[model samples]
Target: MCSLLRSARALATTVSLAFIFNASSVLADVPQAYALTDIGSLGGYSVPHSIDESGRITGYSYTAGGIRAFSWTQSGGMINLGSLGNDKSMAYDSNEAGTVVGTSIVNGQYRGFIWNAASGMSAVPCPPAATCSARGINSQGVVTGYTQIPGGPYRPFRWSGGELLEYLPTLGGSQGYGAGINADGMVTGVSYTADPLPHAFVSNADTQLTDLGSIDGTTSYGKAINSQGHAVGYGADLGNKSAFFWSPELGMVPLGTLGGPNSYAKGINSADIVVGQSQTRTRATGFVWSAATGMLDLNEMLLGDTGYFITAALDINDAGQITAFGKDSYGRIRTLQLTPVY
Candidate 1:
């Protein structure tokens, strides 16, 4: 009887060890996510805005004298793309083919530009007396953004192969802004309608606009749209803001905050992983959310000082990498990237 009891105990111990080993192996096989790497500046500070599938990063950097657009390569260092004759420029989005779309101050006014390694930067024509800014560019080089008309409201526009077209008509209000564009040329934005309230909207390729109503007791804005037509943004509910993921199938599903009163979903990748920022009881922090993991604070994942505040997660890629900006201990703003831990 004693021998049998000992044998049973040994078997149980072996099984437990095997289970732990398998679990560890599985985690190891998955890429340990959450690596933060600083994309160095051009003799100044760098703020990464977007990353393509090829790992190319585009953003703006402050040089000794002014801000300039930049593209960072995984192999090479930061390459500066000078402005269109002004002292400041910003790169908003880059396509897979390495083409960058952004806005530059030209002749004392804002103008959209498309930049490439071969041709440098060229102005994208906009309606007369309108200030244009490009927000997103897809693989096909189609750029989507909004144009501010002189003495009037802003209107969304789309540019492809050097031809710019006015997007859907505005919501009978004075301001409209396009935030993101997907591969299919679908655009999402926020506009003020007849009710004098801001509402989220989606525009189809053919220029049909559909209003994506806000959450109950809240105002909403759509930030980013994925290829699957999944849109993520934030809505203020009962004086508190919360992130939300929307689709035709599931409608709007609220992604609760990180134990705080406010959260915003800024980017959504093809895998449905969402990246954004959330405020906790003490400080703000970057977060990644998915169906499996819900919401996770990137600062917690790094085991860093949680007292610091993360302001916003600007973008995320399909590889689960994130780019954001936050305030450090000394009150200086810093750009950071977080790679998943598998």
Candidate 2:
């Protein structure tokens, strides 16, 4: 009887130890935390829009002259991307080749521009009297954006080879926007249907647009696209906005907020890691989302007391490097880069 009792106890102890080991292994597989680096401004304040694979960042920063586009690197610091003329320029996206695309006020008119080290800022030719802006660019230098025709609706367009302009098809309404492009030349943006409601959409390589329906039937905007053709953005239902991830397999899935009703996903990477801002109980907070983790507050992942909380995560690279905007205790905004610390 004593021997049987001992055997039973031994078996129970072994099972408990095995369970503990498996649980610890699962925890070890979780994502790594991040360390913050404050990339200072050009002058007053700065807002980062995109971060490329090589850690190059492009955005608009306030200079004494005005708001000017800038490209920043770890070694070179911030270099102002001169305007098309003598006005303001705001860079929206940059490709791996260091090509920057954005809109600049040229000769008192808004014109889309493509800039590279070889060629200085050059305006993307548009129809006469039309105001255009380049919002996103891919690895192949394909640019996507919108052109507003005077007395007409905004038309989404794709520019290639610095010359040809391909107008994308609208759902049914007149106004549409091209916000992002992937390495495969797929574009994602917002389009209004016959219902006159804005719906997120993704375009195939053939430029055929597929409407990604909204979460609650109100409005949706596709902000960025990933290598897998997945898109991330925000969808609103009766004015309540929620961050969403749309895939070819799954339609629009809401990424719930951190105890609030509003969230906006702005950037996604090849790994399908999504970063954005969410409204927490107190204020707007930056967040990172993955398949394993639904949403993790970036503030909770800070390695040390960075003295500022991230307000919005604008872009994340394949290396898990995130470019974001942070607000200090005094409400001053600054651009920051958060690198994954394993």
Candidate 3:
């Protein structure tokens, strides 16, 4: 753990810090009010992986038949995205237009698929004979993910058009996965390196790799990047993992855990606000972080009492809305969205 200090006090201690804030000021640093609207599931878990600028959400859920993809909106509610003639399908990310990209099994081969309300789901474009998965899509409809072509290791690629598949270079490693893409076409993800560590890289163009090394650790996985080129992810430090924020201006800065041994930054917005999971003394908890306020437990930021215990915060939008999963009043996991209220 790092020994960095905040507020003139050491921050790297193993003690849980969720209780560190003074009782009176605990909710003062965050919005005074928050509202929750549970995104109902298909009789089972409704996992949300990403949120678009327009507040559309996409991910996977379990119905009576089997697992299926779903898209959610404030007006329309949850709608199941049928499978690709298989029992498995997932919706990882969506673009501004509510188009989703994720993996599906076709003829027993894993394939990438993109879906929109207008056209439904279709196999995505790829190099000949290559197996692929789409992890992210930008507002302009650009897609980024990994491809496993025969005779070649898995490599990240960007697709602007059907035949315009551009492979990105790795950090001299065997595989790379594209995790996030911003409007400028900058892709951020993990690139396994010759040093045997998963180094994060960001590139606007497909030919070059600008690897973001670990923050005093051997592993750096950049999970999300924003329009400002700010990135957030996690890295290992002294047997403990911690979330991190990255940029040309700040480089890599660790966001200490919630008083536990591990933390992961899963989403970042244009304002540089971050959301993810962190280890508390008892279990993993959702967290929101900002440079000005440091890290705070999401549950603590709630405006009123509730039975839910947020476990993982998967994504956040510039509107200050957060997508997450947690135990509901009945102790069952459920997908939830948090909107800030003035």
Candidate 4:
């Protein structure tokens, strides 16, 4: 994500965001089955990285000096979660009660931060001069992500209560990241397994980390986990990456791509519905999958003139709204929300 923001900041510009789902394209005045609304940027580019059940979004917006983290809501719109006296910050996840978490650049290094409406944005402490970021927060206010010491690989961490950063156990190697956390205080992320390969992991309330074996039994990285302990992610297998749905009952269920050999499962809702990106031989495609529906291309389901060629789905809410990154009618990348009308 840091790498992506760096590229977006370099290509930042004012893009006129406008498109029409007219009758000439698909249906007449039947109303859009899914409305794709642009979440405008603060300056350069705005990407909605994660969305909570309440439809609150948190991501980064590139500015003139640098990028800034932002929190957006239907009623409140976009609010810039300012940096820690620096020019860059990127938001990753928000939980119930409107608390946002991410990383902020402070004194030339990246550090974690928790943003709230009343208290504003404040730094969550770690080792001095370390690159750290918070990825997800649960309703219990526990923030999870990774922290890196100088010249060291990232180590997954948990911040709870006041100023205590707890490092979770690694599977074997020194690198790890906590990408998503559930209401049960379970965290899902990637950790190097015994083979020194990235594999999905889950942390219990006791901070005991469990390795959820990869599809290839060699490489995997977890993305999201629902309240029911079902985790979703991607794993390299047969020289190709594939999206997966993992649970205690079924283990890892592969979600094949749309005629391509690559797919990723980014976020999962309480209903076990998963959404993410997939390869289509030529370009990336957004996908939504479930036990009942399997894996289906989002663009195919979004009939009419939605004007969105979604390439990735970052998050999905319980109400079936998907926050995706895609190109507009003119091929400009935009953050859009697809709310099912039916």
Index of the highest-lDDT prediction: 2
- As for TM-score, the candidate ahead, 3 or 4, is 3
lDDT over C-alpha atoms for residue 246 of model 4: 82
Q: Count the backbone clashes (under 3 Å) in each candidate.
A: 8, 0, 0, 0
**Scored by Cα lDDT, where does model 2 land?**
0.85
Q: Rank the candidates by TM-score, best first.
A: 3, 2, 4, 1
Local error of candidate 4 at residue 101 (angstroms): 0.5
Taking the tens digit of each residue's C-alpha lDDT, what string does model 1 give over 1-342? Answer: 433333353245335434643554521121344666666688866777787766778889889868899887778778898988755889988878889989888777898888999999887777757898888898888888888878877887777775656666666666778888899988888877777777777788878777777766447888888887778888865566778777775566677666667788888887667788887777787887765446677666653443445577778877767777776667766666666675
Consecutive 10-residue window with the lowest summed lDDT within model 1? 24-33
Error of 2 at 291 (Å): 1.4
| TM of each candidate vs. truth | 0.84, 0.89, 0.90, 0.87
Q: List the residue pairs that clash in candidate 3.
A: none
Query: Tens-digit lDDT track for model 2 on 1-342?
Result: 433333353245335433643554521222578989888888889999999888989899999999999998898898889898888999999998889999999778889999998988988877768899999999998999999888899989888864568999998988899999999989999999998999999999877999999987788999999888999999984457878888876578777677666789999987667899998778999999875556789999998887888999999888888999988767788999998988
Please report, as a residue range, the 10-residue window in candidate 2 with the lowest summed lDDT.
21-30
lDDT head-to-head 2 vs 3, winner: 2
In model 1, which regions exceed 4 Å deviation?
A: 1-32, 172-174, 303-311, 327-332
Q: Which model, 1 or 3, shows the larger lDDT?
A: 3
Instruction: Give me the runs in candidate 2 sitting further than 4 Å from their true place.
Output: 1-30
lDDT of 3 by residue, 161-206 (tens): 5766788988988889888898888999999998778998898654
